[model samples]
Target: MSSNNNSRTLLVIALVAVVVAGTVPATVAGQAERTGGTVVVEEGETVDSLEAFGGTVIVEGTVTGDVSAVAGDVRIEGDVEGNLEAVGGSVTIAGTVQGDVEAAGGSVTITEDGVVGGTTSIGAGTVVVDGTLEGDAEIGAETIQLGESASIAGDLRYGGNLQGNTDAVAGDIEQDSSVGVDLAPTIQPIASWLFAAYALVLNLVLGAALLALFPRFSDGVADRVSSAPARSGLAGLGVLVGVPILLIALAITVIGIPFSIVGAFAFVLVVWIGIVYGRFAIGAWLLSLVGVGSRWLALLVGLVIGAALGLIPIVGGLLNLLVLLLGIGALAVGLYSHWRTARRREREPRRGVGPDGPTTD
Candidate 1:
């Protein structure tokens, strides 16, 4: 087989190794995602926040509230009145701003004309700050470069290597690992909440849509999923850790690998479906909770809740954990139920071979 064909074949075969897609869900999705698209928040664009996943986010107008994203590239050419957070390839500020800027990506740049009233925090491969910082500049990266034009009025503190083209009385500077810009940890309340919000909304919307379009199919899947959520969750989690090991094991063997490979492909397909399915399921419940009994109402409520929850703290974290557990539980239950049902069916005596004997009739 050609290399491409072999790879495609191998890819299909390898999917069987998966077990779970542990939730931290949005981040997991965005970890390898890329974003690309100009998002012009036109004048009078009254947006409370901006969120882009696995794509480019371009702000050419104004955003009045906090902007958070996990994307490919985030370019701000307008103005932000609040905080900016992202996990991306590059963050470029070429406009005016009125808040703190926090970013984790490959590189971050603030143009000479850029204006930041609050702190500028970053985690990247390289950070070139030529803007005016009214507050502190806590640059966390592999290399920090400040042009002569850059002015940071507050304390300069960072763990990464730095070369200041300008000078300041940085209150602290530490090269410790902990000081580096770090992705928010899971157990942290807000961190978990944000994650949950994303998953909940995403899953809910996806689930509702799927269910709505295919009521019977949706019901069947939901029944299965809800019935075995824990098992499914454990299975998903297991897949998270075991898939890689399984793949390695497959690679080690030759004759035993054929079917193992196909299962791997099927596994990936299942996960993608499950994620969408779970999200939609959550969306439906959210709609009902908000007193939106209409189908359309449920969708709008789900999306809105997703966005809002993403902004919340404790509740948001709970939302994430809840959806994850519930979804997994459903899947787990479905499997257990199916197994039990099958076993019961098998154990039942045949009509012709009844326990009392067919001659009784």
Candidate 2:
């Protein structure tokens, strides 16, 4: 049961990572693009960075910067000059990483030929180390195994059952199950509050950026939500319920997997944008009530109120959901309206004034 739970948690984490990687803009210097299919760095090839989702990621060449993936499997057979971060069904590293390795998944395996030059942190159902790690290892899993070939130059800290070859060398070995317990009742509430605060700040920052980048679209979404509350809410509810069903149906077909992944990514992106727009709308309304007309002030006030409401028990959750729905609907409607208007204008017959002073189409 514990192993099963851990596996499920890893799966959830992988999916969430996929959604995030699909939506968030990449900041890498080279090869920054989104793909629903596998990303391969073939032998003798090199890349500055790579981010992929849905399909397996195989790195058999070299990477000068970070490599991240959320997929079925991540296999590193060459060398990573920088950090490697991955969430997947399984992670297998048989290469050399000059920087850190952070992985969360069903299983993490560092082959006998693998070499990690920096810290290695992993959370999974099972972990097997049969390589050389020059830095500390922090692992949380249901089972951990260190093979005879394993050599760690730094401290080893782990939770859960452990088995290792006596020949395995490490600076120190320590068991710390208490860290796992802290994730439960003891500190969950505090963690939740901290996460909420962080989310509030992040949203505020993103919202401000969005307002600056697309002021007209932002205002249109907010106005639509205010002008058609019922319609927007209903549309949002439909999208919230319908999109997942569509994705699941698409996933049923083997050839449709990529499409489903892309759809899922788009859905998540829409929800996030909707939530930001909804919060901005709320802030705008609050400011209007106070006879203030500053978008910045409105955003600050709305975010504070929304974050506070989120702290509430059941009511807060429901309110947030409603707001999210409203925002999604409004954005969708506004975009559609704009597109239709553009199309109609393009289709209208061009008119010219003749010398007779009569307009002709």
Candidate 3:
């Protein structure tokens, strides 16, 4: 394939990795994974296991357990006592792996210093191995190059034409016609759609619960969003930006630390509430325009519409941000109004009954 085609293929591989990685729960097997941005295992560091999602993954240390990565690129120049599984745009190994190696990328390379004690499986656009493979090797690639120093103790099964294999030592070498077919293009969209569906269901359930528990309050908030959107939005922006600053300021003092902790938790909860409320407000307005008066219907419409718009790229992100701000602001405005009403009642003078009539002082 041409270089451009290879690059496109790699991009697809990276996308597949990102989509799959995003779906993993926060914790797995007693290990918390790092998501987004670079993940690195520096030299001299030893970890039980390593699992990374998105961005680049680089390992230069010793891992007692498996090293699994779904990212843009993966480079391992250390030792893995367990298996190594990497799926990304590019994968490179220049160290010793005690267990199996399963790698899929646009470009996969195992340098001369690399050694795999277990089987090695690879799917890529271009693959080069100048290392030692103690077990069988199953590779599917557009181009495969085996260095003269490469030594495979077991059978080698490959889909593409082999180069330098004449000088490399290996067991039985067979061609597998099925290995080179690319499935990423077909699978990525399906995976993304499933993720979106999952998110929609989760949001719908949460919205339903909120509406059920606080029907009147929910309606008031929705109305606030519809009637005073500009005010609500401004409030939301202030809360979003101001809350953190307040929290930090509180945390700076010894006595205010406890309050800060409580506030932090409350802030997270309020943000979630705002997101839901914002969507509900839009839905309620839309329903009003059509002369409908059903809270459930409004929530459904708003959430569905929000999810649909989220599918768009930049526009979707911008809209979601606006929705969040509006929802948060509306909540702030409502609370402030309640506080002011209470204060006003406290300040009002009481009326006393006189012989002739009632009198206020």
Candidate 4:
């Protein structure tokens, strides 16, 4: 397979993935609609941006925004103010599309009544066009047919057998043989290393900032992790498991949805901090054994060693998990201690000698 074929295959796969993603329950923050099963926009009906994923999708009304569908069959016989994108077993257009049309399927067609104002791109097993295309047309298929009424305003580039009324095309007609999947080249290893390097840099910067801004708190967390590794690990495990459960419970309600989202982000940040702290604590402990007390040096040593171990396979992953647990647990324990102390102080009575002897505050 050639590069063009590879590109087409990727496009089709991506289209399928998009449809699958739409099935997940997620709120889009605007005037958009998403649904599964047979979807039909009845005549005289109007909708904003629409996405359908299921057996069949048909539009006979007016769409003021873009329309996208991934189904067994999709047919449009309406007015679309925005682009029309579809991937299915069959796709047909018999309406006025004010924007581009991107379609991939077993069979794709543009009926006589179809009128496109922008470029048209299609990838399918078979393609037929008998409409007005005001822009360029790039098609990849096993078979292509352009009806006598077909009118393309721009160039036509396609793959496979072309048997149609070429005279109706207003621009150049060309054949591209290489329009399928290409299986060559490997870049996963390089990409992995690059990602690791980036992560290391980010962690180093973050660690430096934490040590500088909150020296006492950072030292205390490290001390707790070093002094009570078992306790810290248990706490970390609880947090790792419990946070998700709590978030999910919150997400079950419409009112709690926003809070759940915010909590999720905050949880991620806490986990990252824990990971850094875990490494820093280990470095500090190791340095202490050698009678060293430089916090900066400890941080550098711990992070570098952690990064190196990360390159190993199973051992690296396990070690990283352990550190994350220890660090998070220590942080949690320390916070609980602070909260308790504050509460105790607030409850304690302050005495002042005055005319009423002693006054409690």
What are the lDDT figures for the candidates, one per model? 0.60, 0.78, 0.80, 0.80
User: What digit string (tens of lDDT, one per residue) describes model 2 on residues 193-235?
Assistant: 5446656765676677667656788887777777788999998
Best model per TM-score: 3
Clashes of 2: 0
| Residue 360 accuracy (lDDT) in model 2 | 48
**Per-prediction TM-score:** 0.41, 0.51, 0.54, 0.49
Q: What TM-score does structure 1 among the candidates reach?
A: 0.41
Clashes of each: 45, 0, 1, 5
Off by over 4 Å in 3: 1-191, 349-361
Determine the C-alpha RMSD for candidate 2 after optimal superposition of all C-alphas: 12.6
Candidate 4 deviant stretches above 4 angstroms: 1-187, 353-359
Q: Write the per-residue lDDT of candidate 3 for residues 203-274, one digit (tens) a residue.
A: 676677677666887898999998888989999999999999999999999999999998997797688778
Residue 253 lDDT in model 1?
84
